[model samples]
Target: MKRILILIMALVGLTVMMSGCSSQETVDVTADKIILVGTQNDYPPFAYADENNELTGYDIEVVKEIDKRLDGYTFEFVATPWDSMFLALESNKIQAIADQVAKTTEREERYLFTDESYFAAETVIVVKSGRTDIQTIEDLEGKNVGALAGDSYTLLLEEHNTKVDNDIILKYSESGNPAEILQDVQNGRVDAYVNDPIMINEVIGKLGLDLEVVGQALVNDDMGIVFKKDTQGEELKGLIDPILKQLKEDGTLVELSKKWTGGEYIPE
Candidate 1:
């Protein structure tokens, strides 16, 4: 009887040990995660610091909604300069960025962009008022084209130049000040500048500059969140893709777009 009782106690101990190991394994897989999201503080209505000194915008709120839906991941937004966001992401200092990042060949080579894009921006050639002669990119041969250096518009023109023998002078501004670039167009420093219609309207309307889009979209880019091209990036994308689709279906993204951008900016 004593030996039997001792054997039973030993079996119970073995069972408890096995149960503890199983629980630990479960915790390891389903443990809470803290994801660091990089955002810009100046891209108004998208990701900006408000007058109340709080970081709030369309992209900001979108990430927040994603966090609220996800089970274990907690997003901590780190607002930094536009350029610094990429530096931090490359260094692994941040896990993701929500600053209206668009997928380009250069960026896609180094980073991972989500399959679902939440926003769209169309780039077109903006010429001076009453300039109907300059319509498309082909018409801009022997003309100076102004765009922000290293941006999508510049990339578009660069690719176009490579494909054709045309001499489209690409004048780029490193400062990324749309006002200054647009002013250069008005002042005749450039024959035309490439920009989004929304931005062109905003700047030209405010500054009262006489500029107009060619009414032809040169590049329509669907913007998505960006991540490091690694296993972590892949897994995070897998997690986000489904939730993003749900947001679109449930009209949450539309509401957010309306709240911030004042229009339907989400891609159909």
Candidate 2:
């Protein structure tokens, strides 16, 4: 009767209120509150811990810029190991990965690549300064080259390793991380180390290692932010592409590179 009708209407009102609150929560999920994932705190110049142990580096800076471009947003960082970084992104542990990920056709299939290329880089051969024996790319043939496992350098070496000849062994350093592989080269356990030129200089600057970019650079690469392969990234990609292009045009990226690596980082 009339009492029953009144109770039903009251219940409907409560339901409507709950729905409104849910919608408000959705509206709050704009870019400001987005989360990012990156490697462990020691990937210096890209992502690392500062003297105060706060997470800081180039990737953090560029992601902050991206947050600025996406009005009403903030950044939340998730520190993951290099091996687990991709999986963390895959599992939605973070909204995106701003860890200087390079675009590859294979990864493109598994992830959504931002049209924005935040930094341009290439692999380089590093050895002692006085090593005139390894002068060019060709000279790396039959030499003991080492790099971190699961790094982009490994992929590059895999491609070019065979080109040198099947006789030359593409030795993989048994180290768990990049620093160890670089150390192997410095300690004379390996003839050379192949890594990103920017990263090499940055690490060397930090450790005061006497190394030089010995051979010609390998594989030119464009590093981009990574997101899960989904419709959500589609809209974000459209918005971020132009912002990155503007950063490059205005030399913001070059400035960031110098701050991080103390080297010229202009896109070539």
- The per-prediction CA RMSD against the true structure, in angstroms, equals 6.8, 5.3
TM-score of each: 0.76, 0.78
Q: What tens-digit string does per-residue lDDT give for candidate 1 at 1-268?
A: 9999999999999999999999999878866789999987755657767788789878899999999889889999888765477889988889999987778978989889989998888888898999988988899888998876556777788888888887789887765566678999999999998766776776687679998888678778998989998899999999998899889999999999888667887898
Q: How far is candidate 1 from the true structure (C-alpha RMSD, Å)?
A: 6.8
For candidate 2, lDDT tens digit of each residue in 1-268? Answer: 9999999999999999999999999988764545555556767778888999888988888777767777755667887777778878777787687776778887888888877688777878888768888866567677888755556776766767666564334566553466766777778877788778777787887787778897567778888888787776676677777877887788888888889877666555
What local lDDT does model 1 show for residue 113? 92
Name the 10 consecutive residues with the lowest summed lDDT in model 1.
40-49
Candidate 1: the clashing residue pairs are: none
Q: What lDDT would each prediction earn against the true structure?
A: 0.84, 0.75
Question: What's the number of clashes in each of the models?
Answer: 0, 2
Q: Over 4 Å off in model 2, which ranges?
A: 1-32, 167-176, 263-268
Superposed Cα RMSD, model 2 = 5.3
